[model samples]
Every structure is written in structure tokens, then in C-alpha cells.
Target chain A: MGDISKKDRIITAALKLFSENGYHKTTVSQIANQAEVAKGTVYWYFDSKKELFQAIILTGIQRLASKIENRIKEEDDIIEKIKLIVMIYLEFFDKGRQYFRMFQEGMLAVIDDNFKNKLMDFRTKQAEFIAKIIEQGKKEEKIRLDVDSKDMAYLLLTMLTSFNSHLHYDNDFNIISKKDTIINIFLQGISR
Target chain B: MGDISKKDRIITAALKLFSENGYHKTTVSQIANQAEVAKGTVYWYFDSKKELFQAIILTGIQRLASKIENRIKEEDDIIEKIKLIVMIYLEFFDKGRQYFRMFQEGMLAVIDDNFKNKLMDFRTKQAEFIAKIIEQGKKEEKIRLDVDSKDMAYLLLTMLTSFNSHLHYDNDFNIISKKDTIINIFLQGISR
Candidate 1:
């Protein structure tokens, strides 16, 4: 807590309060108190609560993008790279379910047009990241050449997104342990 | 429209208005006007707008379940049955995007506990239906035996659900032509 910057502290506190009490009910004063900063300090970093909430979402998306980029760069085999992509998604959601919930709220809640546009932009960028991986897989001859990389990327992403919805209903279902099994099904069709 | 029952008329108008203007913005009188029925007549059928909204959701779910049940029975091949399930899902969403939006809104919006529990029940029943199909596929050697039927069902359902989200982002993406492509990717996966 001592090492964390005031900006980081505010953002962290905002995410917790927003997720727990929801966006409208959560106040900047509450965020300031949680972050151990003065009410005015929250404004020092963000102009408004809406801006702070948007920052929380953008930060999480950027963090995910960087993690996927770095992890996939560490792998060479196309199939292995794809598996890594799937595993990263599961791990991200499984570990950051709260942040994921925040993101969903940000998307669904009545946010400003600018915030809505940013959310949509993040979705497009995420799909593009996966599309790039599928493109690489196709070039390596590991994935089918017949399928459109973009569509396949969307499909893969859709599967992962659906996994989030599934987890919402069955929280007890262990996604972490099913990681390999999930990847296996994605990698090699479920057919014998 | 004339042949439709009063209850059906009320539900239909409510669904459209709710999907378009949102739940809170939509009023009972507006629904009554749209249905060409008296304001009191609307309440004669549904106790509240919430009840009417729940009825719309339940009707959609029941219709989908029955469609899947009847369609699967006509197909003997387990794989075909599963494919039929996928096609039916896409068709349902495509034809009923408004209703789907209502369902999503119902899910994201703050609703009564009864509505929330009903939504959860519909989701569980959906996964169970898909699981039954996967179990049959395994028995016929159409699908792999190593994977858990429930997990696989959830996975397939996840893929379709993702498709809906994808549609939200890229409305131009033609899911109909990509049906085989998507089903192919799901059944055989994207691997070469």
C-alpha cells in the first residue's frame, strides 16, 4: 500500500466500490476513503467518476492485451500458441472475475457515448488480437486455411466469452482445472 | 395479429416496447396502446410489467426448448442433432434479436428475485439439454468420450452465445453462410 501511487490507489478503490455498490451508488468520496486519500485527491487524478470508471476498464483491457502479447511471444508452435491463448483467457477471467464483472457492468450500464464507444473499441481490438494469432496459425499450417481468420478469431473469442457467461451461472464449476480439457476441445475438435 | 390472443398481444407489445425503449422508460399504457387493448385489460392478464416481461422471456425459452426437442428427434445422427441444435440457436437469435435484447436487458437490469431465479433456471435447463445431446453423441461415437458431456455442452453453448456477442459488435458478419464454417470449427475444431 505504501509503494502504490495515488493514481493506482484511486483506480483500485474505484474498481472495488463500483463492482460492489455499482456505478451510480458508488461515490468519489467513498473511493477516496477506501484508497486512504482525501476526496480532492481522487479528482487530482481523474476529472469525474465516469472518467475514473473508464480508466479502470481501459487499464484492465490494456493489461490483458500486454499479457497475451508477451505470453504468446514466448511460444513458437502454432497449436501451442493457440492453446496458450485459450489458457490465458481462462486464467484472466478465473483470476479477475471481479474485474470481468466490472467490465460487463461498464458495457451494459447506461454509460456515456464516449465510454460506450471505448468499450466497443476494446472488444474490436481483442478480436483483432485473436485474429492475428489465428492468422499466424494459418500461416504455420496448423489451422485450416479454409476458415476466415477474423471469423475464426471471433468464434474463438465468442467461445471464451460464453465461458464467462457459463461461469456466471455455475460459479462452483472449476474453470482452472478444466483449462487443458477446454483447450484440448478447442484445439482438436471434440470428435474422436 | 387478429388471431392472436389478448395475452399474446400484451406480451408481444411489451417485448417490443421493452426491447426498444427499455423497461423503465416503457409504460403499461403504451403497451396497451400498442396492443390495441385497454389499460386495465393489460393488468387483467399480467399483474405487473415485471410479470409481463418475465412471461415474454418464458415464452421464448419454452419455444426454444420445444423446437430443439422436436428438431433433434427427427435427426438420428448424433452429430446432426448437435448441428441442428447450433443452427436452431443461430436461427432463434437471428429471428428474435429484439427478444434476445430483452433477455439480455432482463439479465443486466436490476430485477426482482423471482425474475432472476427464472433466468437462472432457463440457463441450467439449456445446458442440460445440450448435455443430453452430447451424451448421445458420445454413445454413438460421434464425439469424444474423454471430455465431460456437461463441459462440452457448456462449451458449445458458449460458442453460440459468443456468436450473439460477436453479432453485437460486427452486425455485418453473416452468420448464416458461416453456419457450416462455425459448426465445422466446433465439430472438427479449427485444427487442420
Candidate 2:
């Protein structure tokens, strides 16, 4: 019981199973065997499969949120802050490929309604953060004020969602690229 | 027997089965029974289930494409052309609610690889059509050529996908209702 780190062990096992069989088919016993932990041990850390799955999503979102918060905390300018978001979001999925897979597949037709609600709430926060950026840019005369920030934020989020296809199947279909194409497009789009 | 209409019989049965259960679950027997036709009669026109589904998608896509084509056909300016596309796309989805449901629940994930490829190709044509509008806009000095036409088309598509959530959910979900608000944001962005 005291021999191993439970949480890390659980996440590692869950990731493998989720990647292989998808979230729906994989069960606690399989994860327990892979983690080399007892069945009770897995349940102790995660009450159910849905909780474990939610944990994965929450961890990914929180990680992204914290990273974004830390990056923007250093900058006072709105434009610079927005730049960090574009780069960080792309990088986060790049680094956490499994999370990206889970994010896309689970986000589409996942079982948990509450988790989806949480996701929608997180999306609101992300949009709010973008709106604030647009507001600041407007105040500084770098952005147009006539247009609403909320809608624009939704636009950016959609672009980000499609951007996942780039990571998943870059050669077959891409949402962004190594040419810094998206970054340039955003800058050209907003440059006053 | 002669009074049984062909178009109404096939589609009415299809929409019922596809919506009630799903595309994959509903079989040809049920469809033929509902249509008051033999299985061979259903096969005579459709060839197979995949072909039938393709026929359904074709019906939707053609209807949308022709309407956009006709609306923009009279306009000389590219700005007017793009506006027509946006208007047509949103209006069609609004009015054609059943087709929209079929479209949103696209059989990309559940179908055979060959069938999925055909569907994806059809989608690519849509993106190409959008890119052509942007390309024409560039020639007309309406949009910048520096940004890739395909990418910009994708941008508009992405925005539409995100905004669709607002339509389905009762909550505004932070997206504004005003079309001009959205159009202005797309046209001018946050930048002054």
C-alpha cells in the first residue's frame, strides 16, 4: 500500500488504457493490473471510471489554465498576453498528446453531462479571458471597440478546437502548421 | 401502387429511422417495410445503405450549394458574395433543421473507412468553395491575400461551429445574438 505513488500510478495506467480501448470500454481491473496496484487501491483514488475520466479532463484544463495564468501574469500589455495564449495552447496539446486525444474524443460524445457542463464553464472562462484581452486592446487603441469581445472569443476558441486536428493528423489534415502560419494570420488579422 | 411517390417514400422512411435510432442501427428491411416496398425495390434506387446515406447528404449539400450559387450569381462584388454565403449557410441550417441534425451528426466516426473518405471529400469540397470566395474577395480588394484562402475559409467555418452551440443551448453562453455584432467582429476583428 505504502510502496507506490497512487495518483501518478493511476494516471499512467488510465492513459494507456484510454489510448488503447477508449474511455468507455476500459475498466478499473485493467487499470489496476497495469498500475501494479490492488483493485481497492484504484477505487480508493478514483471512486468510479467517470471520476477518473473527469480527473483527467480537470487536470488537463487546470494545467492549461495555470500555465496561461502564469504566462499572462508577467505581461501588462493585452497584445503580448494574447500572444502567449496562442503559443501556449498549441504547445500544451503538443506536449500532452494523450490529453489532446482524450480532450477531442471525450468532448464530443462523452457520458458525463456534469463534466460537459464543467467543460462549458471552462470554455466561458477562456472566452472571458479573451474578452478581457480584447477590451484592453480596445482601451489601448490596438483593437476595434465596435465589435463584441464575447463573440470574437468564441471564434478564437473554435479555431483552437480545429487546431487539434493538426496535432492528430498533421500530414493528412492540419489546423495550424510549422510555418507559423496561424500566428501570422492572427497578427495580420488584428494589426492596426 | 402507382400513387406511391418515390422521393417522399425514401426520405420520409430514412429520416424517421436515422433520427429515432441512428444511421447504422436502422436496416433496409425496416426502411422497405415503412416505405411499403420490397427490399429489392429499396435496393433498386439506392444500391446499398451507404449509397442511400450518400444520396441524403448529396441532397442536402446540393440544395445548399445551389441556393448560395444562385444568390451570389447576380452579385458583382465579392463582399456581397461572401455575405450571401454567410447568410445562406446560417439561413439554410436554421430552416432545414432535419438536414442540420443529419449534418451535425455526420457518420464520420461510425462508418466504414471508404464511406467516411467519401464524406470527408464532400466536406473538403465545401471548404474549397469557401476558399474560392476568399480568393475572389482578394481579387476584389475586400480581403487580404496574405492570409491563405483555405485558412480564412476555415476560420469562418470554425466560427460557425462554435456559434452553433448557442443555437442548441437555451443559454446565450456568452455569444451575442445580433448578426451584425458577429459579422462586424468577423469583418473588422478587434483591431482598429
Candidate 3:
């Protein structure tokens, strides 16, 4: 029980430090101090600083994917699934804003080939997941038949991501309203 | 004439290097070498590497703003103006892909107070520009009167930026079709 809690604490500490100082500027000792764990204890869970960074990123993506997938599995209505997905997305990023910032930085950085491959796979999976939802909508006749599910999926993902990004840049933005507005805009064009 | 040409070359080289290696990894001497100018010449035109970076970003923004504004002025029809604006935006970024990549990096990086203020001002100007178009549409009764012009402007801007970003990540994306599709989706939406 203690081992599990110690590992979780180390991860939480590393995430905050990495976000504040960036991957290159942050160090293991700082993470240890922040976590209030012995330096050697970090090594027990992760091999090195690089591995820990990778773990933080990989874990974030995987956790988000699984959470969305599990919740979506319990839903049958296409529109409801989309609304739920958007809510989950906004909530996840809202809670882990720092982690998302780090993720964006990691994307631009020239990382190792293994990490690059993993990132690519994650993006593909995300797009595919959205596409599946659009496909389901089409089957239910909830979406326009002429619409390409893949294109619409991409567009929806873009809308959600961009709206979330704006929230980070502008603090005064009303989150709940923004989420609803995004969904409304997606469903109905700004037409009379 | 020679001095002006040298300055142009220096800016061009610096833009490419900075895009490839990021701001910190790049150096003034490397920029000079790439530009085929002496190190002193780079210092002559720009006080520091930081200034050069600001110049690259500011130039890109100003040029885009001017181009969109001028073309918008040429058209009285709101729909036509929107189409032309989208075309020009895609063309500008497609031509200067490297510069766009660098701009995104700069936004994420920690910068000086002056630069941050300028960035904020630039964003306001951009949103205002878009809002102006939407307001015109509303007056022309081409758009829904109930829609908040400011929110719609932000949404349109988000769609354009996100679509352009996806182009960078996915090389197989068809640019012209994507542009048309984004405009279509914005105007009509994907609902049946």
C-alpha cells in the first residue's frame, strides 16, 4: 500500500515540476524534494528521468483513451455519446492543464524514434475513435448522409481541441457555456 | 540596395534555422553563416537573436493581417469576403510553413513582457478583424441575427487555425479540398 502511494506521489511531483520548468530544465532531485520521497524511491518506480517523462506522457494519453472508451461503451445514442465525449475531454484537460501543455511541447520537440512512433499511434487512435462515433451517428441517421464521417470526425476533434486551447489562453472564458456552444455550433450552423 | 538585400537574406536564413532547431538551439553566428553575411551584419540589423525572432513572428502576423484586410476591403459581399479570406490564409501559411511552426513554438515559450503584450494585442486585432466580417454579414441579413458575432468570429478563427495545424501533422491531407470543406462545414454544419 505504501509503495503504491509513494509511486503516485512521485508522478504527481514530477508532472508539476516538468510543467513549471520544462523537460530539460527540470531535474530528478527537484522532483524528489517536491514529492517528499527519498531520491532512491523514484528509481524504484522509474528507471531514469527520461523514462519518467515518457511515462507521464504515455500514461496521460492512455488513461484519457481508456476513460473515454469505457464511458462510450455504456452509451447507445450517438448524439449523447458525442456530448459525453466532449464533456469528458474538457474535464480531463481542465484537470491536467499542465500535462497537456507538456504534451504539446513534447510533440514539437525532436524526441526519440520510439517516442515519436508512440505519439503517432496515439493520434491515430484518437482520430479513429472520433471517426467511429461519426460512423455510428450516420448509421442511426442522426448525421447528414452526405457528410464524410472521417472529415466530420476530424472537424469535431479540431473544434474541441481549439476551444480547450482558447480556455487556457483566456481565463475569463466561461467553460460550461463554451462546451455547449461548441456542440450547438457543430449541430446547427449559425443560420436562421 | 546591397544592405537591404543582405538584411532580407539574414531574415530568411534565421527563419529557417529557428524553425528547424528552435530559438535556443539556434545561434546568431549560424544565422549569419546561413545568410552568407558576417556575424557583425546580423547584429547590425537586429540587436539580438531574440529581436530577430520577434521580427519573424511580427512580420508574419502583420503581413497576414494586411493581406486579409486589403482583400476584405475589396469585396462588399460578405460571403465572397469570407471565401477570399480563407484562401489567402491557407496560401500564406502553406507558403511559409516553417514560419508558422516557429510561431507556434514562440507562443508556447516563455518570452519577455514586451513580446507577450504585443502577442495579446495581435490576438485582439485578429478576433476583431473576424468579428468585423461577421458583423457585416449580420447587417446584410446573410447570417442569423441571434448569433453572437464575437462568438462566431472566434469559432471561425478556431476552425481555420485548427485545419491549418492538422495540415502540418498530416502530409496526406488535401489542402484545397480541406479549405472548401472547412468553409462548407462552417456555413452549413454536418447535421441532417
Candidate 4:
């Protein structure tokens, strides 16, 4: 339990620094100092800085996935389920703005192939989750059968992430209104 | 005339290098060598590397804007004009994949406040341009009157960019089919 706590501390500290600075600029030494652990302990806990960064991202993705799973477990309506999912995402990123920033940095940075592959895998899995919901919507006759579920899921997720980033940049925007707009547009589009 | 050619060569070489190796990794000396000009020539044309990058982005945006304007000048139908705009964008990026790559890098990198602000300005202008189209559609009774044109435009542009980046990473995907899917989703959505 102590080891787990220590590792968590390192991750928490590293995430703050990485998000505040950047992946390339943040050093393991700074993470160790912030976490109040010796530099050697940092190395003992993780093989390298890259590994530590990967661990932070993995933990974030897992946590978010579990949260969404728990929130939507009782919801049967496809449209309601999607709304709940979007709300969960907005609230998740709102609280974990640092994590969102780190994720954005990870997305854009020409990091190593391994890191890039991992990010892509995360996105693919995310889209797959939404695609399954879309498929369920189709089965329930709530969604259009002509459109490809996977493609729609991908585009929907893309819009969600993009909107989330916009929220991060501008604080004056109302989240509830924006969320409704997104849902409305996704379901009905802009055409009369 | 000779000086203009030299400057153009430098910009071309810098764009290639910056896209291949990121903005941070590519040096002015390397750009000069690639352009077959003296290192001092690069500095004479631009104040700094950042300025050079800004110039490339500005030039790309202007060129794209002109092409889009020229193509849609005679088209009276809003939907057809939108199709033309999207096609022009796809073709522009397809021909200048290097510029698109550099733009992505610029979007993600925390180079400086000036650079970030400039990118945001470019996006805002693009969104505004799309917003005008949405307004025209609404007037034509082709678009829903309830939606905010600016917000809708912003979302539409975001999806276009996200899809463009996806194309950059994947080669097997059919551009025409994806373009159709995007337009269909934007206009009709996925609901039954």
C-alpha cells in the first residue's frame, strides 16, 4: 500500500509538471522534487520519464472509462445515454483540466512512434465504445440505418474533443448550453 | 525579381524541413543549405525562425482563401458552394501536405503567445467565413433557424480539420466517400 501511494504521488506530481510545462521540458528530477521523493526513488518506480508519462495517460483513460461505465449502467435510452456520456466527459475534463492539457500536448507533439501508437489506440478504443452505442441506437431504431455507425461515432467523438478544447481556452462559454447544442446538432444536424 | 525568387526558395525549403522535422528541430542553417542560399540570406528575409513560420502559415491561408473564393464565386446554391469549399480545402491540403503538417505542429506547439494568437485568429476568421455561409443557408430556408450560425460553423470547421488529419494518418480511406459522409452528417445528422 505504501509503494502504491508513493507511485501515485509521483504520477500526480509528474502530471502537474508535464501539463504546466510540457513533456519534453519537464524532467524526472523536477517530478521527484515535486513529489518529495528522492530522484533515485523515481527511477526505481518507473523505468524512464516516457514510461511515467505513459502511466499517467493510462491511468487517466482507465479512470474516465470506468466513470462513464458506472454512470451509464442504468440508462437504457440511447439518446439519454449519449447525453450522460457527454456530461460525464465535460465534468471529467473540467475537473481534470491539467490532464486534458497534457493529453493535448501528447496529441500534437511528434513524440516517439510508441507513444503515438498508444495515443492512436486510445482514440480507436474510444471511438469503438461510441460506435457500440451508435449500433445500439440503430438496433433500437432511434438512429439512421443508412449511416455507418463507426464513422459517425468517430466524427462525434472528434467534435466532442474539439469542443472540450474550446472550453478549455474560453471560460465564459456556458457548458450546459454548449452540451445541448452538440447533442441537438449531432441528432438533427443543421438542416431544417 | 531575383530577390523574390530567393525568398520563395527559402520559404519552400523551410516548409519542407519544418514539416519533416518539427519546427524546433529544423534550424535556419539547414533551411539555408536546403534552399541553396547563404545562412545570412534567411535572416535577411525574416527576423527569426518564428517569423518565417508565421509567413508560411499566412501565405498558405491566403492562397487557400483565394482558391476557395475563386471557385465559389459563380456558384449560387449554398449547398453546392459548401461542397466546392470542402473540395477546395481537401485538394489544397492534398497538394500541400507539408503545409498541413506544419499547421498541425503549429496548432499544438506552445511556441509563443504571438504564434498561438495568430493561429487562433486564423481559425476564427475561417469559422466566420463558414458562419456567413450558414447565415445564407438559413435565409434560403435550407438550414435550421434555431441554431447559432457561428457555433454551428465552428463545429463544422472542427470536424473538417479533424477528418483532414485522419486522412493524413490513413492512406486506404477513400477521400470522396469520407467527404460525402461528412457533408451528409453535417446536413442530415444520424437520427432517423
DockQ of each: 0.37, 0.18, 0.39, 0.32
Number of the predicted model whose TM-score against the real structure is largest: 3
In model 2, state the lDDT of residue B101.
Answer: 46
Error of 2 at A96 (Å): 4.8
**Candidate 1, B65: how far from true, in Å?**
0.9
lDDT of 1 by residue, A137-156 (tens): 77766777777788777667
Candidates' TM-scores? 0.81, 0.72, 0.86, 0.83
lDDT by residue for model 4 over A54-145, one digit each (tens)? Answer: 88887887888888888788998888888888888777767776676665444444456786676667778878888899898888888888
For residues B1-192, what per-residue lDDT tens digits would candidate 2 score against the true structure?
777686569877876775444454578888888888888888788777767876676677777767776777798777666666766666665555445444333343234566566656655676788888788777767776666788777666545543443343224532334555445545653122
Residue-by-residue lDDT tens digits, candidate 1, B1-192:
459898878888898897775565678999999999999999999887777877877788889889888888899887778789999999988887656655554444455677667766776788898898788777777777778888777667666764665454445556776798778867884222
What is the DockQ of the complex in model 1? 0.37
* Candidate 1: pairs in clash: none
The top-ranked prediction according to DockQ is 3
* Ten-residue region with minimum lDDT total, candidate 1 chain B: B102-111
Interface C-alpha root-mean-square deviation, candidates in order:
3.6, 5.3, 3.3, 4.0
RMSD of each: 4.0, 5.0, 3.3, 3.6
> lDDT per model, in order?
0.74, 0.65, 0.74, 0.73
Checking candidate 2 for backbone clashes, the offending pairs are A144-B190
Q: After superposition, how far is residue A124 of candidate 2 from its true place, in Å?
A: 2.7
Candidate 2: segments with Cα more than 4 A from true spot? A1-7, A19-21, A24-47, A94-101, A107-113, A162-171, A178-192, B2-67, B92-112, B158-171, B174-178, B189-192
Q: Can you write out model 3's per-residue Cα lDDT over A1-192, one digit (the tens) per residue? A: 446598899999999988765665577899999999999999999988878888888998899989999999999888888889889987886777667666555455545778867867877778889888888777787777776778767666655654555444454555566667666766664222
Candidate with the larger TM-score of 1 and 2:
1
The per-residue C-alpha lDDT of model 3 at residue A73 equals: 90
